[model samples]
Target: MEILQSAAALQAQTEKWRREGQRIGLVPTMGALHDGHLRLVQAAAAENDVVVVSIFVNPTQFNNPDDFRLYPRLPEADAALLGPAGCTALFLPSVEEMYPEQSKLRFDFGSLEQVMEGAHRPGHFNGVATVVSKLFHLSRPHRAYFGQKDLQQVAIIRQLVADLSFDLELITFPTVREADGLAMSSRNRRLSVEARKKAPQLYKALQLGVRLLEENRPVASVKNEVLQFLAMEEAITLEYFEIADARTLQTVEELTQPQEVALCIAAWLAEVRLIDNLLISAKSL
Candidate 1:
């Protein structure tokens, strides 16, 4: 796989691909590759003639300095994994390459930025938008792939694509999980042995919430039970557990009608922050 590090080099390569009439797919990621990430590349490779995976640990998106510093970086290992996954190119840009100067521009999604991940991490989505917009422009791919594990980020990017008039299809795959049901994450590497053992509880809690909701239980009651369920796990510190409209991400209090619902959760397993979600259609309601 070709590793293109600078923006100019990447754009030139993509332009050449475009001139050749080859369809391109872009998978943007930070460099700690796992099976979940490789699955995205494989999926992209199956559909597009060329798959470019960008591995840049975007500094602006991190609200906590410590989290930024502690975030995993394994470029060599990532490249080794991506090679067999059919990745055509790896856009591994440095911080300096991505941002030569401080950016003055910021993007706001209004209501989309008002809850859950947005509320907990102020200025987070703006930074995500800034970098994502840059990637969308630089790669100029016909399609982009992201995991449903980041349901909110997908929603924000969908809005970014629409509002900015970017010409590309946004594709999302279901959240990848371990045999024990823990959603696979790069941060899972940072978990201590004991903390790792308790991490699956997050998915279990979400599963319980889904069962209760499917049984026609009240939303408020389901929320309370899920909260109480997580509280029993001393190792996990729950940040937020929300059942929101799948598309708008607005938290719902009652299931008055049939609609897609996203059960989202974010919590701390030791110092590593983890987030996961489950999407279900409330047709039974």
Candidate 2:
């Protein structure tokens, strides 16, 4: 697999592929490769003639300076895994390369940025939208792959594509998980043994919430039950647990007309903050 470090080089190569009538796929990631990330690459490889994986820990996306500092970055290790996953090229750009000049523009995603991750991290989604918009333009792929673990980000990107009228398809793969059900993440590496054991409880709580919803329980009650479930687990501290419309992402009090919805949660297990979600059709209840 080829490793590219500049937008010009990546665009040049992809242009060649386009001339040859080859479909290009792009997977944007923040460099700590885990099974979940590889799963995205695997899906891209299955559908596209060329798969480009971009690994740049976007500095603009982090609201907390310390979290930015602590974010894991192992390009060599990430490349080692991608080499075997059939990736065609790795767009490994520097911060300056990505943000040639300090960007003064900010994206207003309307209500989409008013809740969940946006509420907690002020300019976080703006940074995500900016960097992702850059990657989409740079790679110019026919399709892009994202994981469902980041449910909110997936919604934002979908809107980004529609609003910008990007001609590529956005594909979302299911969240890859551990044998015991914990969602796989780069941050999972920082969890201590005990926190690791308690980590699966996050998924378990989501599962319980799903069951409650399926059983015709009220949306508000289901949320409380999930919160209580997590509270009982002493190792986990609830940050936010929301049951909202999957598309609009607005918290719903009642499952009135069987809309598509997601149960999303963010919590702290020790110093490691984990997020997970489950999507379901409330009509199926």
What TM-score, over all chains together, does every model reach?
0.99, 0.97
Q: How close is candidate 2 to the true structure, as a TM-score?
A: 0.97
Residue lDDT tens for model 1, 1-285: 999999999999999999999999999998798888999999999999999999999999999999899999999999999989999999999999999999999888999989999999999999999999999889899999999999999999999999989999999998899999999999999999999899999999999999999999999999999999999998999999999999999999987567999999999987989998998898865
Give the C-alpha lDDT of model 1: 0.94
What is the Cα-based lDDT of residue 102 in candidate 1? 93
Off by over 4 Å in 2: none
Question: How good is model 1 by TM-score?
Answer: 0.99
Candidate 1 error regions (>4 Å): none
Clashing pairs in 1: none
Give lDDT tens digits, candidate 2, residues 1-285: 999998899889988999999999999999899998998898899999999999999999898888888888899999999978979999999998988899999898989989998888899999999999999888899999999999989999999999999999999999999999999898898899999989999999999999999899998788888888888999898889999899999999999765998999999998778999999996798
Poorest stretch of ten by lDDT in candidate 2: 252-261
Candidate 2, pairs of clashing residues: none
Q: State model 2's lDDT.
A: 0.91
Q: Give the alpha-carbon lDDT of every model.
A: 0.94, 0.91
